[model samples]
Target: MRVTADLDLCQGHQMCQVEAPAVFGTDPDTDQVVVLDEHPDPALRPQVDAAVKYCPAMALAVTD
Candidate 1:
């Protein structure tokens, strides 16, 4: 699966980090949510899905 985060739409809520710490995080300089691993391991699909679902800004997208 693949993950994408729209910086423009993000509010830095950090929900992605909570769900998938290994695949997402906040950029210190931009203070925005960043996709640490766009193409994360298959094992991380569940957490990534949760992150996308919980994104209040609707900034995250996932695709297989």
Candidate 2:
């Protein structure tokens, strides 16, 4: 699966980082959500899903 974040929609709430720090991070320069892993290991799907769900901006997208 592939994961991506829309910077335009993102407000740096950091919920994704909280939910799945392995796959998401904050850009210190911009305070925006960054996708650490575009394509993640299958085992990480659940956490990735949680991050997506918890994102208030709904800026994260998962493509399988």
Candidate 3:
């Protein structure tokens, strides 16, 4: 699976990072959501999905 983020829509909430630290992160300066692993292992799909779902800004997406 692949993870993508819309930085413009990100609100620095960091929920994505909290949900899936292995696949998502936040920029220290901007505090925006960052995709740590654009292409994460299938084993991490559940985490990735949770991250996307919990993102308040709705900036995260998954493509499989």
Candidate 4:
């Protein structure tokens, strides 16, 4: 799977960070969503999907 975040669409809600710290985080300098791992472990897919779904600004995307 592949994950991506549209920085312009992020609202610094941090839900992604809270849901998948290993795969997503907040960029201190920009206050934008930062994708830590585009291709995370399969075990982490669910958490990543949760993060994507929880993003208030709908900034996160996940694809095969």
Number of clashes recorded per candidate = 0, 0, 0, 0
Candidate 3 residues 12-57, lDDT tens each? 9998887889988878999887787899999988888999899898
What are the clashing pairs of model 1? Answer: none
The TM-score that candidate 1 achieves is 0.94
Ranking by TM-score: 2, 4, 3, 1
Query: Which portions of model 2 show Cα errors greater than 4 Å?
Result: none
TM-score of each candidate structure, all chains considered together: 0.94, 0.97, 0.94, 0.96
Minimal lDDT window, size 10, model 3: 25-34
lDDT of 2 by residue, 1-64 (tens): 9999999999989999998999999999999999998998999999999999999999999999
Off by over 4 Å in 3: none
Q: Which lDDT tens digits does candidate 1 get at residues 1-64?
A: 8799888899988999999999999998887898889899999999999999999999999998
RMSD of each: 0.7, 0.5, 0.7, 0.6
The alpha-carbon deviation from the true structure for residue 12 of candidate 1, after best TM-score superposition, in angstroms, is 0.5
Model 1 residue runs over 4 Å out of place are: none
lDDT of each: 0.92, 0.95, 0.87, 0.93
Q: Would you give me the overall lDDT of model 3? A: 0.87
Maximum-TM-score candidate: 2
Give model 3's clash tally.
0
